[model samples]
Target chain A: TQLLEQSPQFLSIQEGENLTVYCNSSSVFSSLQWYRQEPGEGPVLLVTVVTGGEVKKLKRLTFQFGDARKDSSLHITAAQPGDTGLYLCAGVSLGNQGGKLIFGQGTELSVKP
Target chain B: IAGITQAPTSQILAAGRRMTLRCTQDMRHNAMYWYRQDLGLGLRLIHYSNTAGTTGKGEVPDGYSVSRANTDDFPLTLASAVPSQTSVYFCASKASAGYSYNEQFFGPGTRLTVL
Candidate 1:
């Protein structure tokens, strides 16, 4: 089975602080996606990176796919209270597995204003 | 339009009781999915249906069942609820337009507590 492990499971930081969350795995994936979930709500898609070494930016957030497609990262610049939530990384394996997405445990960010 | 909606926003049930979570989408998506989220365990897929009348088991499908009778609804049933099955359940849908990647629209989620 393929598994994606995320680092710094919990993070608490003051507003304006920058942070990075990493997702690593031994298996390679064809695509990786980042999602943000607020309390009591379902996750919302942030971005999708399909190529190795690909980088995508959305407002204050930046996402990067590793050179080997086995890992990915999300960097938040000047995080604010609005950025506090659960960040999840999900990957689609080489075959896509009928559109299945394997998810990481997730990194919970608490940004105090 | 309401992209997706789930019934019984939250539910409390006793062990061994049967429960069904209803999901409906307005986008007429071709694929629908059911996922359960637990503390420290992100979201695990319980079941999925690529199209109407076709369903398949997902990573954690042992205690659950799903049916996709039409293009817009996919309901999940728990024959005998267990304490371990208590978790936040989410319903998602994708257009599956043959693209390598697509965004999945998710519902607000249903909070289920089994005791």
Candidate 2:
């Protein structure tokens, strides 16, 4: 069973449009991370949020950790074709000491030029 | 420096055959993990090692096995390959706890097919 759930599994929009993806879980987490994966390549970490109610920004991408530590969201502004890829969210359980990370299904995004 | 490397970028194996996927990291990370990615299941952990000489099972560890002999290498072996074992496998490593906030460096990946 999947511990985390992601919304809008597949998304497609024209360039310059903005989009947001959500990741939710019933369990609390110590840290949550967002990764962008290109075709045939491993996932690359985009951002990591540790504290609840924290917001981080990387260029035009904004990431927010829910105040309850049970959810997170990723927002990309002025989406470009280069932003097209698979977005994944992973969370570290509070009880995880060995660094086990639980992952969500993933959101495949496509930005049309 | 090469963060991580995986062998046999892609392979085709027959059922009941034994195969092993190799992963090595030069970062000397204390933790290593093996994950498999499928269509809708995303990435599922198979096994992990917190440090050399220690290994533990992850969410999905049925037909797979792993061993960490040293700080640099972790190999995952499939004693009996099955069609269900077909998937893209990834190897990842991270700095010890308290040093890194769950950011994992992943290898390119290995695509395996069991017939």
lDDT for A23 in candidate 1 is 99
Q: Give one digit per residue, the lDDT tens place, for model 1 in B8-114.
A: 89999999999999999999889899999999988999999988999998899999999888999999999999999999999999898244478888999999999
For model 1, the superposed segments whose C-alpha errors exceed 4 Å read: B97-100
**Candidate 1 lDDT, tens digit per residue, A38-100?**
998889999999999999999999999999999999999999999999999999888765668
lDDT score, candidate 1: 0.93
Worst 10 residues of 2 chain A by lDDT: A92-101
Docking class of 2: medium
Poorly placed runs, candidate 2 (over 4 Å): B97-100
| lDDT minimum window of 10 residues, candidate 1 chain B | B96-105
TM-score of candidate 1 against the unseen true structure: 0.97
Candidate 1, CAPRI quality class derived from DockQ: medium
lDDT of 2 at A102: 91
Q: Model 1, residue B107: what's the lDDT?
A: 96
Q: Per-residue CA lDDT of candidate 2, range B9-90, in tens? A: 9999999999999999999789999999999888999998888999999999999999988999999999999999999999
